[model samples]
Target chain A: MLYELWILAISSLVAATCGIVGTFLVLRRIAMVADAISHTVLLGIVGAFLVSQTLEGPLMLIGAAVVGLATTYFIQVLDNAGVPADAAIGVVFTSLFSVGVILVSLYARDVHLDVDHVLMGDISFAPFHTIEWNGIPMGPQAFWVILAVFIIDLALILLLYKEFKITSFDPALAAALGIPVTLIHYLLMTMVSITAVASFDAVGAILVVALLIVPPATAYLLTEKLSRMIIVSALTGVAAAVTGYYTAKYFNVSIAGCIASAAGALFLIAFLFSPSQGILLRGRQRKKAAAPASS
Target chain B: MQEWLQFLSSPNLQWVMAGAALLGLASGVVGSFVLLRKESLVGDAMAHAALPGICLGFLVFGRETLALMGGAALTGLLAVYAIRAVHSQSKIKQDAAIGIVLSVFFGFGIVLLTMITNGSYSQSSGIDEFIFGQAASLVGADVQILIASALVLLILSFLFFKELKLLIFDPLFAGGIGLPIRFLNALLSSMVVLVVITGIQTVGVILMAALLITPAVTARYWTDRLGVMAVLSGLIGGLSGAVGALLSSTISGLPTGPVIVVTATAFFLISFLFAPQRGILFRMMETRKNTQFVLNNFLLDTMYEKLEKRYAAGQYSALFSRRELEEQTRLPRNGLEKTIQALQKQGLLTQTDGKYVLTGTGLAYAYDSSLLRRIQDIHLTHEAELGSWKEASANGDLRKPRDYLMNERIHSLLTAEQKLPVSLAIKQSSIEYADQA
Candidate 1:
């Protein structure tokens, strides 16, 4: 029982890792794009499989991440060249997914990726498919890969500190400084893709989207600073994952559904009560802003 | 062809096609303005929100028949009105309001559905197709409803054309001019709801948004004029519906709605590539043409004037060095070098005299259309007006409404004692309006 709980703990940590990266994604209003990336990563999976016969963790992660980044980069590049962001996203992802579907049909007799499996994770089955090195369990590959990606995200933030801030906050100013705003966009997008694909094995594709978006969005409702938002989102995500997993176990219901619902609940809490960015709360703020001062 | 003819003539398929065409035409016409308003995806949310309406309808009527469907449609219209109310009365954003309405309404619908299933009323149909989209279930009455709805929307749109344009493009100006912008705004939102409900029997919600958006977006690439955009969008949409209907009939397992969406996407790709003004092929050809003209002039005036010699790289290279070349004269450096290389390939200029002499073909291309430059600029600005309009609208500027509206209001309300003008002028977002896009 303790071991099962530990496994759940590791899974939540992975969720937290996804949430940390997701904060910026929601902040830049690229949450739907994150959803599109999750749907479109099948192309990268097929590409990876064509190159390497196995679904060995690192190979799949890198392949998916690269494709994810490329997708985001092209979308932004087209948007910059006068295409609206949503239209560009719609164009790129649907076209790529069509190609992916064609390839998936042409290459394999039976499609390996199940849509149901992609929508929801099977935690009971997750424990069975384990890998180890010599003596240590290395926890689960889901946990470690997400952690490594999280670390890489932190490193990228550290190195390109000023550029990410400027680009995310004010692209015009960033462009004025001659910082390759486009390059930073691609870099951040690549990280998003990597994080998406990394935890994908544990929590299917669509739920990964729900995870990536909901926590960061909830965090957005709570705070403003980059670092603080990241931390808050991660913590919130981890808490939700734990509560959600146990709730699923208790109810004998859908793990993904529970997690998504819990994250949605967190969003509602913030929506109802958050000081500045909440929906109803923001209306109050607006009313206050518009009010004349008392003498 | 015979089988397809028979199929097209068949009543069921006829119902499907009519449903598709009506939904397509209405969405095309209404969606053009919706896309212009950037409320494209609000349809998608309303589609989902219509679930509670469906559930409620089913609850009252005891099935998924026409009356229940009407109830669902009413719910969708009300949701759209609510969206307008929230956006107008409050500071909630369009997208966020959509998200809020989508989840809450859908969540309630789900709960209602769960309760219905729990009770004796589990005989619901069309819910499956309602989530994605199902174009196969349209019967005769459904077809009639779609056609009537489309006709109503078209009639209303024509009657309210000038008012709709003003409200969509310059709400502030319309408001200032004492035109019931709120009523017109509600009217447009209601039209979108009408489009979605008409679509529910055909496209459903998830892909319905794409249908509403994609044709309008594709049409946007082709024309600056809103009327042309509306007509073109309707054409694209109708064609896609026809194709989707035909293809889905041929294929056994394919769903009607997705196939229709895919077909629309095909039209979009075609527009992106083949549209005369903003297309990929046109842009590329224009760029090539511009370069060729400058090269031809450079060859005729610069290299050709020099001597009867195979021009060498060094001498005519001066013609290539200038950064800004006139449209008819010497080309810019990059284009000049490319042309010189082509000329060299044709044995015209290859370091024979240290100058780039144009090939006869290259020179001919340059001289072929000296007047093309002015033509090209006209196309470029006109081709991308959607972005320009979006930016301009976001800029919130108005140049010609204060006098017209204020005086109209003063005259109408004070002198005429018009209650409508005073009541209509009670909006805060109406700061001003600029000229047309």
Candidate 2:
């Protein structure tokens, strides 16, 4: 029961962190870059492991962040050179990921890291990797790490709320007003990288992308206001984490996988039933509008 | 040498090589259309979404390749449908929709994979090979299936080539022509799914997209025609596949999928840097040449304008110093010197001591160019009734405008309307204005 609580806390924190940063990504229409980053960060993890001979410190986060930014940079370069955006993203991420896989197969074969672990991270083991604070168990290390990330992200968003909002809504206006659009973009990308790194330990790499994209996308259908959207996105992510945990327990399957699946389910529900943007609701409204027009 | 010989003769390795090459060829042809339609990542999502279908196929039918591929095709098409539904039905964009479908379906597949792994299924051991793709595990039956699928895909693509091209390039027009746009779209989507199904066992889900994307993209750097691009992409993909298979076999612990991706990326880098027209290096050279050409033209125009007054004064051999030309044009000193040297080399200008003058050929060239410039000015100033000036301006050579809008008739029309001032008078006034400034 205690371990389950820790798992819940860790995974929920992971989802919430991902949702907060992912809202910006989805809004910016760069959600696939989130997918690219999640995959290439495996290379970062492997590279960091080789250098530090460990995977437990800030180095891993830094490595993932560096590679995440590099992924964006490469994609931008290709985009500037007239490569289609999808092809640019597809080629860059897949090539980088292949390199990462090759590196893992070659050098880090004996280590705890492997491609499968990177893909489907074992979140059930999160509770066992606890941290010690002055001879006291301070819960799972992943929980603290995710909490710190969540707090830092929230604070950053709070501080730069106006800048982020302007950039997201109207970048040209933001640039006209002398806001550093590129700086904000990379800053958000860095935040996403950190959040992805933090979440991947709990939900694995690919599912971290699900957490990043699905909840925010679902919330986008529900609300028009940015603040409400963020709150709703985080709540949706948390709800998925809880329900996904219980569902995984019921089915005796992978928890991270179930969490992502649950997030998808929530998105489907909002897609069909949201008051403002749901397909069914909009269809009914359109029909009523058309009825008056016919009279 | 010994290992190479053995690898070539080995039947199993030959099957693996053939399988990978066919997979690459089929995907390359199909992927060209996908890339052109801007649905590259949609292919990626479908590839990832195939996992759960493979798992379900395993659970239901138990290790039958045909059943597994059938399930994969169903689910892959479903993923495409889901992406379209999400994108059209909500405010969500296509990229986000693709990301959602990709990760969620993949996540559910992982859950199923875990269930199968922990279950009492006997043959569940080899199934995980579909993740990273163990080429060594590919048997003869798999190779034959891969070959057959590749042929079917190739033939379908060929038969529907025109329809698919129209759909990709101009779908609205295709629909207007009553070409069953939606059916063609579904056909393309199914082709993508078929490619993904055949490729999943070779390249795996995670990197299967590379086989579809890289070669097509690389071929794009080399050509603009869709037919040629499709062929080139297929050839490049096939070559990369064969090379990747051979290299992976030689190197222990190297997976065939990543090796193939790396090989395709290498091809992409090569084309990116060295293709004839679109390559980065070629573009850079073209830019440099364009800059030099523009500088040369500027130098010639400046020299002719300066020497025109002296020529009008009947001192046709008159000269101006490099410093005067530099001050007049305000071009960078180094560029000015290079342009001057190039003009001299082309026999467009003559240099005596430290001064320069336009030769006879150069004077004639500059006069035509200057006349074109003045006529353009007149056309712009009198915007109405000068629509023909745009066609004249489209002429590259100053002499060619005479065939369009610069003939004596148009010149007389302009002069009668007082739009074309006396050429000598205009130059004299501009010189006077220059002196005053």
Candidate with the greatest lDDT versus the true structure: 2
Supply the global lDDT for candidate 2.
0.87
Per-residue lDDT of model 1, residues A1-295, tens digit only: 7557655766686677778767667666676677668757867877887788666667888788878987887677656645566666655665455455445545642555543344344555665565688987755556666668878987888788778878888999999999997788778788878877776666666567667776776677677788788888888888777876787677555555566557767766876678775567778887787786541
Candidate 2 lDDT over residue span A52-151, tens digit each: 9998899988999999999989999999988999999999999999999999989999988977877788889989998899999888888988899999
Worst 10-residue lDDT window for candidate 2 chain A reads A114-123
Off by over 4 Å in 2: B307-317, B388-390, B395-437
Interface RMSD, candidates in the order listed: 5.2, 0.6
Lowest summed lDDT across 10 adjacent residues in model 2 chain B is found at B416-425
**Each prediction's fraction of true contacts recovered:** 0.01, 0.91
Positional deviation of B305 in candidate 2, in angstroms? 3.4
Per-candidate DockQ values are 0.13, 0.90
Tell me how far the alpha carbon of residue B207 in candidate 1 is from the true structure, in angstroms, after superposition: 2.0
- Top-scoring candidate (DockQ): 2
| lDDT for residue A48 in candidate 2, whole number 0-100 | 89
User: Model-by-model lDDT, in order?
Assistant: 0.65, 0.87
